[model samples]
Target: MAKIKDHPLRYDLVNELHARPFPALTVPCHAVYVAIKEAEHAVNRDRAADRAHLLALLDRNGSPHPQPDATHFSGAMGRHHLKWESHTEFVTYSAFGSGVSSRAFDPMEADVFPQDWLAGAPGTRLTSVLIRVEELPQDEAEMLAKLDDWFVPESLAMARVVDGAAVIAGDFRIDPAGHMRFAVFVKKGTGERRVGRIVQRLCEVETYRAMSMLGLMRARGLSGKLNTLDPQLSQLISGMNSPDHSPEEVLQTLLKISAELESLAVQFSFRFGATEAYEAIVTQRVSVMREVRVEGRQTFGEFMMRRYDPAMRTVKSVDARLRGMAERATRAAELLRTRVDVERSAQNQKLLESMDARADLQLRLQTTVEGLSVVAISYYAANLLAYIAYPVTEGLGLSKGMSMAIMVPVVILGVWAMVRRIRHKFH
Candidate 1:
């Protein structure tokens, strides 16, 4: 059993409560802890102020009602309803809630509680109940049962029993929400067993909450990364059709994708804490090439200075010119590579147009040749026909040569008209 110091009750109530620890009960809402000391005489005049501060905390958090008496302050705080029970020299505050949880004990509020009421000495007692039940032995159940009976249900009390051992227990209700409301009792016995249990429970609950928060943060980061990658992929696909795009552009797009993948991989590694997974991703092969863009003005300025600068009168700037030319040549090479397919397509279109024009010209030439042949054939035929008719006509008084000559011109004109009609029909 730990020793409980007997200081003046007016200056030591908080410390006394600290010496006795309680279980860390999980509450659905928040809860509050208040320690009261018995005040005596003019020495502990600040006890009234202490009570006021505790009530203020409750009121600030939306207490249902206020305490009517100066010695007894009451209000609602967190998950619990509270009342301060004060005597001439001893004071105690009772907290009643559906459940009691660690969140109810705000460290900032505890710091603000009046220390002068305890006579300028800070309370050393563990005022917050953070004990757990799992650390106790089964044989101690009888002792715990005895301590349980001491719980006032409506008041917080502790009485020392015989044999330098005292039992402390609390009646706590587990609500449907898994919140626990405890009427705590502490038997003044070995402090080691009780305090050990309380500390363990508090740590476990805190760890669980922290892990949940981390999980949510990691999920949000992953979602953002995926959204960024989606648009980048679309842009890369569209840029593929541009005639001026280079292999470096393609490589740069791929590199950007790889960079995003690496970022995701890094986040995954941190979330999972898997070094092997990170290493595997890094080992995967990737190729990257990017064009180093030089502004046009800067490039031209450098070329002019190299070709015309008078820094060296005798020396020729052939080397500088070669360097400048090399840079231009490199850019030209990249441009050529990127636009090769487009240029080839344009050349093929021109060739097809030339072929169509040649074919049309050939068709016109063939039609003219056919017309000429028709004219010649018609003239010859007309002449032959006229000759044959000449002998017959001479007996009827017509000349053979005159008929042939006249028919020749008529035959030629008739062939020309027929050819024109044929060409018009086809065209």
Candidate 2:
């Protein structure tokens, strides 16, 4: 029997599925998460720099290094467990500690990464969050009081998820310390892995929400630009249908608008695309929570729908308008080109007709000149015949004037016939 060879990537690909497993978080643990991204070209940022930054953080705590070229790492950083993962457009650092902070939703708990280490990060912080995990209180009334005290009542979103295995709540507001906060209350019998997954999803929701809003901000910034470009495009397109404007002039204007629009599209392409992708991730993560109503409070999905969705829609609308404007500009240019081509074709036709008329006049003038030449030749031939026949006329008893008179008509007729034959043969 022949043995089969395995693909080089088979094992690596298989292991990839298990690569970024959720942390097995115990109850009463606290997590601090931060996502960092470049101001521009984040997806193409230097990976080596990110790795070096991660190494710097690990070195601060005297922890072991990740494998060479690792995309993710899980290790102990002092008393806290640190998890770092690299993504397409950003990187995230999360530190999970064994016990909750003494103060509920305390922003100081996020100090797992030393201030100096954070200051040395390669990119800007997109979002930072502090998550508090605790065992679910048996008294529902006490939990409600804690929630009301910890979070703003107006913006709070709370729900029970995973078939009531845990309850989650967040105000989705940045506190004075500049971090979003979330609290997870797990049931007594909940698995540690399930708790970890819930915390992970919460972090992901916040991260993706922040990322998606970047697109909204970009769209809002482009509003004034679009307002100006739209009218200019409309005016240029309208000029196409007006006889007052020349096609060449209109075409120039349209081309300028098209170039400008193309440049704008190129600038925003990545941002818009990344936003849409992040938005999808956000929605998916929320849906996976399988949220049930928190009665008198908004659910996570409902909050996003009410606030976030509208902004995303505006971005999408602006993107469509930009595309539409570009298309309109293209159509206007094509229309102008067609008009120019038609005008040129008409001019060429008139030129050909004028040439044909000139050719006809020249032909008629040449015919007139040929007629005069024949008469002149005939007159000379008659005179020559008269001279040559003078002696013969005297011998034949005929007068010279009479002989010449007889030859004149015959010479004229002969010259006319000869000229006609030449013209016919050439033709």
Candidate 3:
């Protein structure tokens, strides 16, 4: 039997699903994660530069290069293992090393990514994180004490996740070193892969959270612009029914506002969409952790509700307002156009009436002119005929004056008949 042909990307697509697996990190390890994105047009940025930058870092550590067009790579970089992945709008690098810092959340521990190499990165750092993973202390109190010292009390969120497989905590605040920090306490006997997943999720939560907040900044600016445009649009609309402004003027201004609103929508659409996606990812990452509150402290879910969700809501509100304003402008313009059309119809009716009156007056004037033409022609013909008939009248023994008077009535009747005949033929 012949074997069936396979799809071209059969294995590639299958391999892609497992491409970026969680790093199987043993307990008492730390991970430094950073996500970089271009300052503008990140999705369309030069990906080759991203690859070259990764190669430079790999070179510094004497690590092997990834596949020619690899979107992700995991390799040994000196004492630490490095993982890099490229995404649509950003790229991330994760370095994992054995053992936690002797001094918790220490900046020096992140030296796995050399300062010089990072400085030469292709884009700005979206988020940098230092994750401290450790075996849970025998006494729960010790964990609680560490949490208090490491994170701010008011802002800290700590939770037991995955049915107590581990506990994760973070303040979600950038430290003086400009890196966010998260701590994971692995329960004894938990799988290494499970711990890795937890650590990865922690990094993701922060990265996505920071990325989503960019939408908030965009929203704030958009809101201010909308505020300025709103009154202008309202004023224009309010005058639409008033005589103060012509329909043409109102329509022109409305179109300007509508165009600007459309432009704003276009400009921020991608950013807002990306923010929403990032927000969803952050929520999902936190949810999958299945967090349980620790010491009555806030869970990741709760923290997001208080802080992150509000930012997302604000973005949504701004997007909605922009769309609403555009619609309002459209409605106003439509109304004004209708009014303009009605007014034009009225003016057209008046013009037609004037034309009708002028036609009637012209017809009357033409009739009067026809009558005068007949009379004048008859008088002139009568005199000329009488002169031509002088011989006949002389022979009849009639005077020239008597003959002219008699011919005048006859000539008038003949002229009227001739005029009627000509008018009939033309008509």
Candidate 4:
């Protein structure tokens, strides 16, 4: 029996699921993470540049290079192990090293990503995060005391996650050093692999949050543009029912307004869609962490609800407003088009009626001209017949006057009959 052939992409597709493996970290380890993206058109930017930059970092650390088309890489970068992944709109690098800093969430601990190397990045930094991971201390108040000094009290979100395996905390605010901070207090006896998963989820939550909020900025700008169009569209719609302007003019204006609205939809469609996806991801990442409340402290989910939720809602409201306006413009344009067609139809009906009246007048004039032609033809025919019969009548002792008089009626009748025959054939 012949062996069955394997599908070409079978192995590749399966491998993809396991490609970006979660890092295995023991307690008392810290990670420095940063996501970089272009200022504009980041999704479609030259991906080769991103790869080259990753290669540059690997080269500096004397690390083995990843495959030419690799989308993710994990290797040693001097004292720290680097994990790099390319994403749809950005690239992220996480440098994981053993032990936490004595200064709580200190910036100097992130020296794995050097200043000069970060400056040579292919894009701007979307977010830079400093994560401090440590085993839970014996006393809860000790952790609480450290948190107060590390993060802002008003914005801090702290939670016990993974069924009390760890307590995670972050302020959701950029520090003076321009990096966001998170502290993970791993419960003793949690597996090394589990610790990595917790940290990974934290990174995802922050990354997606930042990406999703981009939509809010776009939404604000869109509101300004829509504000300008709303009044113009309203005027055109109002003009549709007015006698001051013609239907054609109103329809033209409606068309322009509709086109403008459609253009805006097309321009922002991808960004809005991406925003929604990112928002869902952020929510999902936070939910899976299974956060439990820290006493007198807000959980990560609650923090998002109070602050981030409003921004996402604003983006959604703006998107909805844009759609509503587009729909309004479309309905108005359709109504105006119908009105223009109706008016043109009325004008065409008048034109057709005038043509029918002209046709009737022409037919009457032709009939009158035909009658006059018959009379003239018959007069000449009668004269010729009188001449022809004059000789015969004279020989029969009949006068020319009687001969001409008798033939006149017969000649006129014959001429009328002949004309009728010719007209029937032509018709």
TM-score of each candidate structure, all chains considered together: 0.26, 0.90, 0.89, 0.95
Q: Between the candidate structures 3 and 4, which one is better when assessed by TM-score? A: 4
Q: What is the lDDT of candidate 2?
A: 0.90
TM-score of candidate 2 to 2 decimals: 0.90
Candidate 1 vs candidate 2: the lDDT winner is 2
How far residue 88's Cα lies from its native spot in candidate 4, in Å, is 1.3
Model 3 score (lDDT)? 0.91
lDDT of 4 by residue, 1-427 (tens): 9999999999999999999999999889999999998875456656799998888888888999999999999988898989999988899999999987788778897677888989989889999999999989989999999899888999999999999999999998998888999999999999998999999999999999999999999999999999999999887877678899888888887888888889999888888889999999999999999989887799999999999999999988989989999999999888888888898999999999999999899989988988999899988999999888888999988888888888999999999999989989988
Clashing pairs in 4: none
**Which is superior by lDDT, 1 or 3?**
3
RMSD of 2: 3.0
Residue 227 of model 4, lDDT score: 90
Candidate 2 Cα deviation (angstroms), residue 2: 3.8
Instruction: Please give the CA lDDT of all the candidate structures.
Output: 0.42, 0.90, 0.91, 0.90
Model 4 TM-score? Answer: 0.95
Query: Which portions of model 1 miss their true places by more than 4 Å?
Result: 1-349, 376-392, 396-402, 424-427
The alpha-carbon lDDT assigned to residue 72 of candidate 4 equals 93
Residue lDDT tens for model 3, 334-424 = 8888988999999999999999999999979988988999899998998899889999999999998899889989998999899889888
Clash pairs for candidate 3: none
